[model samples]
Target: MIAATPPANATIASTGAAGETASKLDAIAAQIEAANQRISSNAASIETAAKRLNTLEDTLDSTRKGSENGLIVLAKADQRLADIQAQIDATKQTQTTGAEAIANVARRVDSIEMAIAKSAAQASQHETVSAITGKSADTASQPALAAISQQTSEPQPRIASAVPAQTGGHITAPDTAKPAGDRANDAARTDLRIAEVEQALAFNKAADINTAKLVAELQAQVSATQQTVAGNTDVIAGTTKRMDTLDASMARMDARIADGERSLTANVATDSDVAKLVAELQASLASLDKRLAGDEQSLTDNSAADAETRIRVGALEAGTAAIAGTTGQLQAENKDQGKRITSLEAGLASVSATAKEALDRAIAAGKLAEGKLLFETVLSEAVAEFAFDKATLPKAAKVELKTLAEKLKAENQNVYIEIQGHTDNVGGTAGNMALGQERAEAVMTYLNSEFGIPLHRMSALSYGESRPVADNKTKSGRAQNRRVVLVVLK
Candidate 1:
């Protein structure tokens, strides 16, 4: 207002200076952003390098531990192989001994057969001598033959003349003396032949008995040897299979080790490459730090971004751990449930089998037909029937009961027979219960005392009117319901 005069140079200089300052600030902001990007990239690369180093350390540690364990396992396997070889050697020795024994038995059997044949020949010869002797004696007894012989012999005529002095007979004393020496000789020969035949027969009988004993013993030995050979063969085959499996396992382990060595080599090369990259990143980070020092105002935004990234990484780690824990818990629950289901299924199958067997037995005994039976009639016929108040079993009932007891004893089956007493709904619950218990006790007592069945093998139980198989309102049903049942418990 005093002069109103403006300098044109001053205005132009101020405008140009303001424009240059704005351009410098924009260039500085771009540089700061590029530096922040380089820092973030370097930080991420450093984190990756750190993780790789930790992984390498863990891998090396695990590899060392596994190699130590493998050495221990290999030592154990070597010992097992040695033991198996010893067992095989012992088995071979046993086989050799058994084979030798069998050969010896065969020789003994052959000797026995030869002795039997010789004895039979001697018996045949004795039979032929006896037949000839009988024929010769018959011929000598013939009158015509005796007369011819006497006429032919000169001495015979003299003997006949000496015997003619006797009143109405031949010379019997001289004639008998003439044959006495020959008869004694023939008799001695026949006795010697009979003694030889008897001795041969005795020897043959002894040989036959010995042969039979040897054959039986040899058969037993052969059978035992065969069983041993079979067992040894199985053992050898199994051992060979196991050895092959172990060798295959060792081969696989060696292959894995080879693969691991290759992998370790690759990892070492990768680590060297990563180390070069880390060095480059560190050089770049140093350049970024120098540049950032010139533009220190840009550091606040980069620092905030790093803090946020750290928080996100921590959250991810926590989430991964939680998931692993949940997965483990679920797996454990699944295992427990699987075991429970298997147990229940097994129990159900056993119960079903037992029930089926019981039903089959009942049908075979003619106590049931098509799942139906006259309960009281079947019980009365199969078991001892008692009156409402009677404690003693009838003789006929005792006999039947004894037969059943004998059968059980003969089979050597331990059975617990529960005599369950039931009643009709004719009395109060208390009274019916008492009556049922009394009836069951009476039946149990009779079976034990009359049949010699052990008291421990029997028990009396009263169901009273609690478990009625038929309607209590009907007479027929009531009769069916009022009964004693013998249940065999396993």
Candidate 2:
């Protein structure tokens, strides 16, 4: 201190201070060097950690990409599955429709077969009746009478030879008187001849009548047979058409089923890929868990410096968590998409069922409309009633006829009326014929005047006792035979 009192030189003190500061700086530099080495090592470790984190992040990104791709593929697969399921449902519906159509066709085929059998039976019955009628008529005619005569007649007398009288010297013979038996025989023969002629006439008349009846019966039988055959043919054709439609529908269903099967097979392959992706994702998750455990242990070991490092660590953890949260959200979205696809499939099935029901109802309504039109047209042409005793309409009949006339006039159309009179066999032929004609004329006059039916549109016909429809032997039949028919023509 006494030496320093010699005078505190500023430069010297500054130099000393500079040396000490340099020394202190050198020590600080040495410590900083050590710190720098530690920091460099730490930086290297951090670089390595960063590299590992980057690698992990890249791996995570790859995993995330793969998971996203897998989810996208899963979504596609789910959509495809829905489409396949829809196709499968459609195929099932088509199969059901085809089965129903086939059943209907089978029923129609059975009806056709039954109609054919009935027609054949009726034709056979008609043939049998015609044969029996012919046999009975033949047995009651000339052949039986000839057989009776042959059994009752006696042998004829032999005539004398003319050459014998010349050889005995021309002896003259007196004419022999006819015997009573001969005369009786001659008269009987004449009566038999007349009776034979009468029998022939009766047989001819009967034959003619029988021939007409046979013709009519044959015609009716043929018509019935033809109608039955036509009906059977129509039924068969309808059945065949239905069967063809069913077959076509079945074919389409089969095709759809095959397509569904192919799609399911492809989906199974896709599911295998999805399984592989899940395994990879599990491996990635396990690796991330190991990394997180290492990070937690590193944080525990750095507890003295935890306050400073914790902020960075928390930031990194937060970043990793955010990434994980984003991945989770993506996975959730994929699952939701799959659900939506399933719901769409169910909706499509409902729509298909509704459409089929609507189509069926429409077809039924059209058939009902056509049937109603046919019924109305038939009713319009039908005869309501016939005249009481004559073809002539009563005053009440005229009133009813006028109503029809007014209806026709309202429709702006012409109507034709035909009056036909029939008589019972009780009356004489000429008298019945005259009465029928008079009744027909009376009806025509009423229709023309009261009903305002034009003369050109009104027609009248008289069928006498000859045209009786029922047996004259019975009172009920005779009453039924006496009638008039009124036909309305379109």
Candidate 3:
């Protein structure tokens, strides 16, 4: 019997499967490239949006500064208006006081003038009475005139007596015919009295002129104060109108600020949405990468299997050719070699059985290796919680790592661990990536140093802000994002 051989159809089928796998790999690669391009485009869009937001923020800041300056200027203007109004009130009060004082001075001057007129009338009437009574009243008039002259020594103190002294001294008492010496003395007294009366009238005229001048000056001052008050009133009114305009402007500014806030809020929401979409795309890319890795692994396994099958087929063909040569030699050596042929046939059957057994052992080994490969896929994952902006492992994370180490030690087969680090979106992409890497490396180092796990069996990877399990808008979500995950593969 001829040694059993794998079918040609089986080889063809394996080749087709390999070709199909290669084609799938090419397709997956193209898809991954497309995804990368899309990611780049999305990143550019996000950058543009961030720039726009920054510009809007700057605009709002400028607007706020301008508004504050406007308020300051308005406050200063208001203060200036208050000062002017105060000055106006003070000026008005001064004008009123000056007017009252001037009126009082005018009243006093009028009373003094009335007293002078009344005294002059009394002097004339006494003169008339003395003339009508003639010599009978001459003796009485002489004593009265002498008394009046004594009383009117100071004209301001005895205005009524001043007029009598003036008239009586000039009248010469009608005793000029008595004696030349007496008449001369009477004439001298009359001249002196006339001189005193003329001096008093001059003083009164001077007082009236001074009073009028003072009244004129006061009126001028009051008129100037009134003008100043009027100007101040106009200034106050203008200031008030300006304040009204400022108030309206401030109201408009407030409205604009409110609108800006609303716009900013809407932009924030849009940014959140964009972040979610990016996250989803990143997750899809990760899934695709995982699938691609699996496919590539399957392809490698299939290729190895095909190479082994080819090697076995080549060995079987060489053995079959050798057996055919021996059969031909035996047939050529003897015509009646039937027993020998039977012996050769038995030996060939034994060789075929050995080959069959070896083939079955090889298949069993392949199955075992395949099972090991299947088990080598990701087995489990655990979270290593970390604080915000910190790469240090927490106590709980250390405990978990310890447990993991123990589990790894208990396992018969070698285990590999992948430490994946992540971070919130609080920092720049590059910074976050660096931080994530540090966290991942920290976890890997802990596994190696504390648990004695081999460095070659662990790997550190940083996803940064690209991968997120929760919304980054909330504190708790951001905390959750800043974490390390250990993926175990056995």
Candidate 4:
């Protein structure tokens, strides 16, 4: 047998596939750079929106301050108006009292003047009666005049009486030709009434003088009060006008505040812009997560494939290590092995076929979602389920794998599945490898049963304790090391 030589066409196929993969990686890199630029621009927009929102908030705060100050001013204005109204009311009450006092003083003055006029009229009538009766009334009138002085409207003048006292003064009797009773009575009454009128005139004159004084004082007071009231009215009017003006200004301020509120309500773009920026940032973060996941998967797959290829290449070299003695046959065998190298290369490259084809199809169809793939790489995720030393799959692990399988089914594309089982270095390498393999197979069986993914498309690999994402020194790390990975390449 010719050392099981592989096909010669494998080299040409690998070269073509490599060229295509390189082109795809370059395209992916360029797209990732574009996405980064877009993300940066979106960040700047978000910053601008934040600044604008801050400015609006500041404006709202200032507006509130202004409104508070306006309310304070309005309260002060209201207090002033109340004080002015009180003053006006008090002034009105005072004016009414003052007017009543003036009326009383006027009535008293009129009464005094009427009394003096009546006294004067009675005196003139009595004197006219005496003059008509003549000299016959003199003797009868003398006693009558002395007696009649008691019944009269006139008060005593404290001056000389009509009949003088005999102790210190002399009196003359009137000459009478006959005794005339009616004439005598009339003359006596006239004399007494005349004396009473003179006394009343004197008393009333004195009263008039006092009354005049009182009238003058009262008039002066009334005039002063009028002036004061006039001044108060002017001041009240001014205050009222000022209050009206302040009320109008306050109303205008209220209207302006309402208008500001309306403007704020209408300008929804401010809030919407900020919300949009936040949503975009979330989208960018999600995109970054997906891209990082793809990149990590690609790195892992590349490493595993490279290691497998190196092992195969090393084995071929070691098998040919003792071929120096059979030089002629070894040369023939070298040609055969050269063909075998192509077979191994083709087999290794085939592992990435699904990813390459899917990416190429996406590019051709213009269905490339931005930020989903940062580079040409397999999309893979892991679910760890193995216990400390156990190879059995937990229910929780099954649930996670089921969810992952559902996602894979939704993808609806050709995909290569890889299950990698790892274990802590608690046992011998052989035993660990066996356990790892069993765990990996358990995962593969679940995927096959759940989604009917062909067995050929899925492979199980055992890393045992040789590969660990965490240190095996600690219990947590050892637990972490004992896990399985589910990788999907697209």
Candidate 5:
């Protein structure tokens, strides 16, 4: 086996050799330190950026919370205003209902008082007529009766709630209406009838004494009813005034409710404006959120970059330390280096003599990888007349390839074959390529079928007219160019 050889020999010369190597190592170490310093500065910058990003993120969060709180407060205020307005409306409605009830009470009281007064006036008229007629003084008192109560909405009369159960008396013919002229006419007619009756009664002394007693009784009853009517009229008037005051108060409440409703509408409009502001804030927040996300992603990316830089710095440090260790070893080995260099130089001459084959192999490896591997052994033959454009191999070509394949089969499996077919430039480039390919495939098929060569061991290539050893201007040159070449290699 060929021996391994060092690329170069080094001698520790008497000229401060260890110091020279130490200087080089120090220079490498210095470069490493500088790289580390640069890496540290970048990391510092990244850290500062990250802190700023975090602060910005926190600020955004606080701002978002404040915006949310503002929105919530506005919503609550709007709700409160709505509730208050509702309460005001309800209060206004209640006042209205109360006023109506008061008015109804006042009307009922007025009806009772008016009915009493009318009945009293009618009774007084009846009593005066009786007095004038000179009826018996022992005439019995009439049962007391109250007039019908009037309703506000309906014209029908019903019992009045405020009217007393008993009064002083009832008239024989109670006037339905209390108009002054109608009452005067009725009184006058009754007086005329009474005068006629009195004249008749004057002739009867018993009737006259009875009439005097009835007149006294009638006068007393009339006086008592007049007093009752006056008292109730005062009460009815007071009640009417109270109802008017209540109506005025209800109207004021309605006005206040209208104002409150207007205020509520304005508040709702303000709420709408607030909502628009909130929407703008939300959009701003969304944009901020996107910016924050970008910042976070950048931070992550920067962090990763920083980590990679640190890893590289760590490797540099390890390499610097290794270099330092090597420098120390170099110093220790310096004294014996001259003798070892002599021995290495002597051995290197022999290795250099055998290195050409190895170098050639390396060069060929590169060429093979590039698909430029040269054929070491080339065999060429002219294919006898194949029918025009036919791919069938000529008998002479087949027989020669069979003989070559038998010789190749005697070699090891490392052997590989390449069949190259060429064509004269007779037509277009495309047609020539196809023809060349067909001729190469025909030759390759003959080799595989006749000689048991694995298809993998053989490769067919078409040169077309691009690579011709002969000129294609003449017939003989065309005939010479249209040939197949079989190449063998390891």
Candidate 6:
């Protein structure tokens, strides 16, 4: 009976050990549940960050499209201006040709007038001769006088047609009726008339020469004006190209920043999740180690006397082996997560470094020039357009302004900013100019008040509807035209 009592005591001890092991397993199960909940929470955070990234990408894309459209409009405007200049040049050329033709016609008319005067003078001399010779002279000179009258009565067309061929010298028709003395006197009078006509032609020629000089000067002035317009167009084109490049760079930077943020969020989540897992695992291992150490001493004491105790000890050893394997797996997972975290952090650092390098290169290369486009962004989405005819800021506008302020602060340069406002051709010029002015002033004020940018550092101006980025005939174009531009100067 005494030997049976000791075996019963051993059975009681084995049952107690099994109960303790079950309690430890239950605790481990609870820890795994907590870890799963943490993982879920981290997953939700990652999803939220991803949604934000998508939204940012969409906004960036919209801004890029707007810029592209603006560039297209500028190119079209340049082409139209060139066409207008060409038409003007053609008109100037036509006017010059017309003036030269008019001068030639006027000179021919003057020559004909002199010819008429000489013919009248010859007829008068014939009449006088007829008076001196009485009826005999009258009969002799009648045919010559009739001929002179007929020549004098000739239409202007005949003189105009004949003048060019005979313009090299004075016009002459030989007369047989007049005596040698009278013919000599007629010759002297004809020479005097020719001299007077030459003087008038010389005066007309000088006037034509003066008119040509005036026309030349006007043409030169117009050409210079056209050149000025061309130069301004070139400047605008260059500015647009620079803006495009800057927008691309900004987009890339934004993408990299988003990527970095995602990576950082994932790393933080992974790190936190791994940390909790490691803590739980270490606690489990510590508890298991203490229990196993106690069980080992119990086994050494009980194995020689109790076969059942030995079997129970073997079961505990197997359970310990399983727990050890789990611990090893968890440690490996932790190590791998740590490596992944390191790699992610390195990737983030590389992205930042690469962006910095690119910015430095751009600055060194003078891509960011004085009076060049530093940054450009639409005021808001189509649904959230700028307040028309009002000097108020929208929430989206504030965000954009904040970004610009940050960029300006980062640059830390002694720069002057020109804030130009534009609008669609929907209203009267005066109204549009007023609206543009209000918007420009609003931007400038916001920059000064919200960002601590000095008022003296910025100037606000309005171009009204004159400098539209798009056509005003369409709804979409009007929306695009209502914009603000920032120009930087050193």
* Top of the candidates by lDDT: 6
What TM-score does each of the candidates earn? 0.24, 0.24, 0.34, 0.30, 0.26, 0.37
| Model 6 lDDT-worst window of ten | 1-10
lDDT of 1 by residue, 175-243 (tens): 222343553443344334334434544554465566657556555655665575566567556655755
Q: Alpha carbon lDDT of residue 488, candidate 1?
A: 54
Candidate 3 runs further than 4 Å off: 1-8, 135-490
Which lDDT tens digits does candidate 3 get at residues 1-490?
Answer: 1211212334345545657656765775676566667556656755765675576667567656766665576566557556655755665575575456445544443454464445445556766776787746356445555544443334434433233322322232324224434544654664565567556455555655765675576667657656755765676567667667766766776676666567666656766665676566567667766766765676566656644644553454456566566766756777544333443344345334433443344345442232221111110111344656778877756765676678668775665555667778998999999998998898889989997888877777787887665457976456545656555544
- Score candidate 5 by TM-score against the native: 0.26
Better of 1 and 4 by lDDT: 4
Q: Which ranges of candidate 5 are over 4 A from the true structure?
A: 1-25, 66-70, 136-138, 141-490
Per-model clash counts, in order, read 0, 0, 0, 1, 4, 0
Best by TM-score: 6
Q: What clash pairs does model 6 have? A: none
Model 1 segments beyond 4 Å from truth?
1-3, 56-82, 112-490
Determine the C-alpha RMSD for candidate 4 after optimal superposition of all C-alphas: 18.9
Candidate 2 local Cα displacement, residue 441, angstroms: 99
lDDT of 6 at 9: 37
Q: After superposition, how far is residue 127 of candidate 5 from its true place, in Å?
A: 0.9
Evaluate residue 230 in candidate 3 and report its C-alpha lDDT on the 0 to 100 scale: 70
Candidate 6 per-residue C-alpha lDDT over 272-342 given as tens digits, one digit per residue, 9 for 90 to 100: 87787868777886887788677666754554445353344334333544644565565576875333233
Worst 10 residues of 4 by lDDT: 373-382
**lDDT by residue (tens digit), candidate 5, 1-490:** 1111111112113113445545654665565565556555555655665565566557556655655665565565556556555655655565565456445544644654465466667666666777899784414333211212111112213223322112222223436344444555555543443344334334333544654565565556556555655654565466557556655755665676566566556655655665565566556556655655665565456545543543443353335446445654654778454333332233233223223333344345542333323232222222234444556777756655666667666654356556666677888888888888998898888777777788876777777777654457865446555666565545
Residue range 1-490, candidate 2, lDDT tens digits:
0000011123234434545545654654465455446545544544554464455446446545644654565565556556555655655565565455445534433443343345345434644775877755433333333332332222111001011111212211111123334434543553454344345445544655665565565556556655755665675566557557756755765676566566556655655665565566556556655655655554445433432333333343335445445655545778753342333233223323332443344345442222211000000001212333445444534544555567667776544445556566765788788767776677678667866667776556666776544456975345545544444434
Candidate 3: minimum summed lDDT over ten consecutive residues — where? 373-382
For residue 284, model 6's alpha carbon misses the true position, in angstroms, by 2.5
For model 4, residues 1-490, the per-residue Cα lDDT tens digits are: 0011121233334434556555655665665565566556655655665575566557557655655665565566556556555655655565565555445534433443454445446545655677888655454555544343343334323322221111222212222322345435644644554455455446545655766575666666556656756665676666567657766765765676566556554444554555576566567657655655655565556545543544455455344434334445645778765444544333224323433544454455544443132211111112243555676777756666666677667877666656666677898999999988998898889889877888876777787777654456875456545766554544
